[model samples]
Target chain A: MPKPERIDPTDARLLLALTEHPRATTVALAEQSGLSRNTVQARLASLDGGAKLRSFERRVDPTALGYPLTAFVTTQVTQRRLDQVAEALAAVPEVLQVHGLSGETDLLVHVVATDADDLYRVAGQILGIPGVERTNTALVMRQLVDYRLTPLLRRAAEQ
Target chain B: MPKPERIDPTDARLLLALTEHPRATTVALAEQSGLSRNTVQARLASLDGGAKLRSFERRVDPTALGYPLTAFVTTQVTQRRLDQVAEALAAVPEVLQVHGLSGETDLLVHVVATDADDLYRVAGQILGIPGVERTNTALVMRQLVDYRLTPLLRRAAEQ
Candidate 1:
């Protein structure tokens, strides 16, 4: 397997600038990061080329799209059919993320729904998947802290 | 309390266009979505004003930052000090997302670490929070599906 790409200090600083101002133009990034416009442009190209800077869809909010309820479903899947189970789960738009875990729970699925009734349907769909054995769902009552990456970027830049 | 801003079908089309081509320029979005450049620009402005289009930072991967290990930590906090516990947890850089759930668990913390040893340290710090009572953590062995919103956007656009 190929080695993972490493981000250097300057690249980290650029990422930090982007984290703070995602819509900043190359000139703006140059001004904010105290780097030349050419450097900012080149670094951005490198990051995008290496697939470090992911697509813009990551920034879209499910709540804004009318699916506000988020839930975590931990499921036990038949070991032999893990791949099939993942494929089936991926086909469900409500299932936002799926992780294979290290314990009794074989899969941890993060799902969102427009409401409780919709959540029930999504969960049922997951349970209906051939390889999914059992599932336990926990609804998110509130979001205390939204997902973030600034702290890590700041630390990397500092280092 | 202010009502949450609602996105119209036209706005949904623009968002779908952006999801398909995250790095697309406003001109590109206009052409792809079959909207005028002025309309695309205005819709973009409204989405930004409503705070519906989140910052691009969410696209950055912690694993790419060398924190390859990911874990979910469920904590039971002292009811009276729930806010205080949240504040403390927010102070930890490795804690990426925290959600207040509707069941026995009070908070579900999504965290990333440099490795298993680092994850241990991060979890220990979380457990050491003043109002934190009990904790259960599950390490992510593999990511079967990444976070995504394209399918939902496609559905919304089509509708």
Candidate 2:
């Protein structure tokens, strides 16, 4: 894991501005955050290159690519072949993410499918993977709150 | 829900190319995808306007903002006050996502915290929310397979 970088109020304020205006130029960000253009430029450079930013792939909604249905699969795998299991899961196109967790379940697998049949097929495929012992599928009925960081950004700015 | 737009092999190929080179210009995209500049421009405009893409905020890592610990809270809520529960969850900055799911749990809350104590506090806050019956949290130990779509895109292109 990369070292956690502390975000100061100024950085948070600038990030909040950028969230509101994703395509904003350095000058605009500076104006919005009440900082100099150079500071904004430097901060942005650091942010872009650092672990601060994740892949742009997150911006691409799977629904657009035809996989609309979303589900979480709690997977239990053999301890010895955990790495191999992860590799196999990655080979499955429907599996979007797999996070090892603490508790009854070993891994939380985020998946998307085109339909019920597709979802069933994907689940079965996951089950068939070597070292994968047990699996539990939970279909997402509605997204109560879409993934967001604006509120956190606001809090950071205040701090 | 908006109508699901069908994506052809050409569109998939273009999107795959864009994923690899997010900073690629329309002309560059055209060259890579073997399509005309005008076609690439038109497609990009449509993609930007359509439901194909999500918010740019997804590119920002919560870890970078000081909340490194990730957990999923399976919340059981009173059915009638689902909307209110969702509203309250949205108000909490740490609650990054809440998905209403089928099965025993009604909502799956994705959250991030600064540390164990922070996580406990956030979890307690969620449980304290009115209409929330019970809450179960599974802390993310490791991200085995980070969220991805390149394989899915490759499959789409093949189709």
Q: Write model 1 residue lDDT over A25-109, tens digit each, in one string.
A: 8999999999999999899888877857667777888888889898999899999889999999999999999999997448999
Q: Can you write out model 1's per-residue Cα lDDT over B1-159, one digit (the tens) per residue?
A: 655776667878998788677667899999999999999989988887786888777878677788889999989998888888889988999999999988644789999999889999999999999989999999999889987888888777776
CAPRI tier for the interface of model 1: medium
Span of ten consecutive residues with least summed lDDT in model 1 chain B: B1-10
lDDT string, candidate 2, A1-159, tens digits: 765666778888887887776656779989989999999989987776677777767877888888989999999988889999999999898999999999634999999999999999999999999999999999998888998888888888898
| CA deviation > 4 Å runs, candidate 2 | A1-4, A25-30
**DockQ per candidate:** 0.76, 0.72
Model 2 chain B scores worst on lDDT over the 10 consecutive residues at B1-10
Native-vs-model 1 lDDT?
0.86
Whole-model lDDT values for every prediction: 0.86, 0.87
lDDT of 2 by residue, B1-159 (tens): 657666667788888887776657778989999999999888877777777778877878888788989999999999889999999999898999999999634899999999999999999999999999999999999999999988888888898
True lDDT of residue A84, candidate 1: 90
